[model samples]
Target: MAILITAKNLKKSYGKGKNTVHALGPIDFTVVEGSFTIILGKSGSGKSTLLNLLSGLDSPTDGTLVVAGESLNKLKSGKLAKYRAKIGLIFQFYNLLPNLSTLENVMISSWLKGISVSKQDATSLLKQFGLEHRINSNIKTLSGGEKQRVAICRSLINKPAILFCDEPTGALDTANGQIVKDILVKLNKEGMTIVMVTHNEEFIPMADKIITMKDGIIESMNTQISK
Candidate 1:
């Protein structure tokens, strides 16, 4: 598989000198195309910081991050915004607008991108995730799992080249987390490159590659045979 992402001595920090907080790397890693890769760690391990940088939500303080041939640290705000639109993002929080219906939440980004997608196009994606019945449901009415699934649908709205998930199943129960995991696994089988950050170790057997972090640096990296 082709390398979809590469981070060379990538680092992120806050404050300076004595007050500085070393949140993340100086870590080097690569994400293979169409692979389900996990950044696993305990709390305060810098996994989320890495995800933010990789997803273009934040810039690295040092080193280099190249995703899909674009050097993220080199892109200005305008160019970064454009680049972000092509990348999918799913958060632990659903981040859906409460005033909007489920379908509206899914289509909002597409509309913002000026993409001409009909309702059926959006509906089909929701339906594929067993959300057809809740197509018009309000965001506030949904459960955690339902909201995450809707968030997943919204992430797919733009047909992103790579998907970045920040603790995607972090807030869900075991069953719901498994459901989300299965969905991601299925999507990976269909060739969507996914990078997720999590503290959960239960997903070890499900990963194509696992990047473990401790105290803002790589603790270990392991590649497993596809499950």
Candidate 2:
């Protein structure tokens, strides 16, 4: 498989001089195309920081990060924005617009990208996620699981090559979390590259590669036989 992401000697630090805090890296890894990769660590383990760098949401303090053929560390602001548009991000909280209906929430991505919003496509995607009946309902009225599903639809509407999820099921109940996990696994089977950061051990078995982090560095990386 092709390598979809590469990080070489990546590092992230906050503050300067005496009070400086090293948040991540001085680490390296590659994400295989169409593979499900999970970054597991306790809170403050720098997993989220690593995700931010990989997704082009933030730049590394030092070293190179290449994603989908673009060097994130070298891209200018405009170019970086363009690159980010091709990547999807799913947050822990259902970051939907409370006032917007499910369909509208999904349409927001197109609107932000200066592209035409396709209700048909949005509806189709939502329906695929079992949210067909909730399309017209306000986001505030939906359950946590439904809201997260809507967030997934929003993330996918632009057809991103890779999806970056940060604690995707953190706020859901056990059953709902399992539903979200199943959805992710199904997407991976259908060839979507997924890089998820979670503290949940249950998801480790589902990933093609499991990366464990401690303090601010990778402790171990385990590759499982893909199903």
Candidate 3:
């Protein structure tokens, strides 16, 4: 497989001089295309910081990060915005507009990315996520799991090359989390690259690459064939 993400000596810090705090990196790794990679770490371990940098949401203070052939360190704001359009992001809290229906919520993402919105395509994605009956329902009316499924549909509407998720199932119950996890595994099997950061140990074996981080650095990295 081709490498889709490459980081060399990547680092991030905050404050200055004696007050400077190193948040992440001076680390390196590559994510192969279509691989499901998990970043495991505790709170304040810099896992989220690493995700932000890799997804082009934040630039590193030093070193290099290239995603999908774009050099993040060299891209300006406008270019970075364009680059981000090709990357999908999911958060612990379902980031949906409460007043928007499920279908509208998914449609809006494509519109924001300057892509034409197609209701048929949006409905198709919602159906694929088992949300066909809830397509026209308001976001607030959906259950936590249903809402999260909508968020995933929105993320995929742009057909991003890589999906970056930060604690995607942190708010759900075990059954619901499993529902989301199953979807992620299916997506990976179908060749969508995924990078997920979580404290949940249950997800480790599901990845093609597992990276464990602690105190701003990688503690261990293991590779396995996708199950």
Candidate 4:
């Protein structure tokens, strides 16, 4: 498989001098196209920071980062926003607009791309995720698991080549979390590259590769047969 993301001597930090905090690399890494990879790390282990850097949401203080063939280090703010749309991001919080219905929330993401996503498609995706009845419901009225499902629908609105998820299953119960995991794995099988950050060990069984990070660097990486 071809490499979809590559980092060389990548470095990021917070504060300065005595208060400095190293959040990532001076390390090299590559993610193969269409692979489902899990990044495991505890709090303060730089998992979130690394995701931001990889997605071009933040600039690195030093070194080089390239994702999906774009040099993130070279993008200006406007360019970065466009770059981000190509790689969908799902967060622990659904981040839906409270006033918008579930279907509307999903459509809004595609609207940002200036494309009018069909209601039929949005409804189909949500229905497949077991949220057909919630299509016209207000986001604030939904349960935690339902909200997360809406977030997943929004993330896929653009049909991105890659998905970056930060604790996507964090707020859900075990059954719902597993449901989300299965959906992600199905998407990966259909050729969507997924890079997810999670502390949940249950996700390990679904991962094509497991990458563990400690402090500001990768501690270990293990690949397994895609089941």
Best by the lDDT measure: 3
Q: What lDDT tens digits, residue by residue, belong to model 1 across residues 97-204?
A: 899999999999788777777899999999999999999998899999999999999999888999999888989999999999999888888999999998777777
Tens-place lDDT digits, model 3, residues 55-134:
88888999999999989987888988898899998889988988899999999999988999789999999999999999
Q: Per-model C-alpha lDDT, please?
A: 0.91, 0.92, 0.92, 0.88
Flag the better candidate by lDDT, 1 or 3.
3
What TM-score would you give candidate 3 relative to the actual structure?
0.96
- Candidate 4 residues 142-182, lDDT tens each? 99889988999999988998999999999889988888888
Candidate 1: minimum summed lDDT over ten consecutive residues — where?
A: 198-207
TM-score of 4: 0.95
Alpha carbon lDDT at 115, candidate 4: 75
Against the hidden reference, what TM-scores do the models get?
Answer: 0.96, 0.96, 0.96, 0.95
Q: Model 4, stretches more than 4 Å misplaced?
A: none
Better of 2 and 3 by lDDT: 3
Clash count, one per candidate:
1, 0, 0, 0
Please provide, for model 2 over 81-104, each residue's C-alpha lDDT reduced to its tens digit, 9 standing for 90 to 100.
888888999999978998899999
Tell me the alpha-carbon RMSD of every candidate. 1.2, 1.2, 1.1, 1.4
Flag regions of model 1 displaced more than 4 Å.
none
Worst 10 residues of 2 by lDDT: 109-118
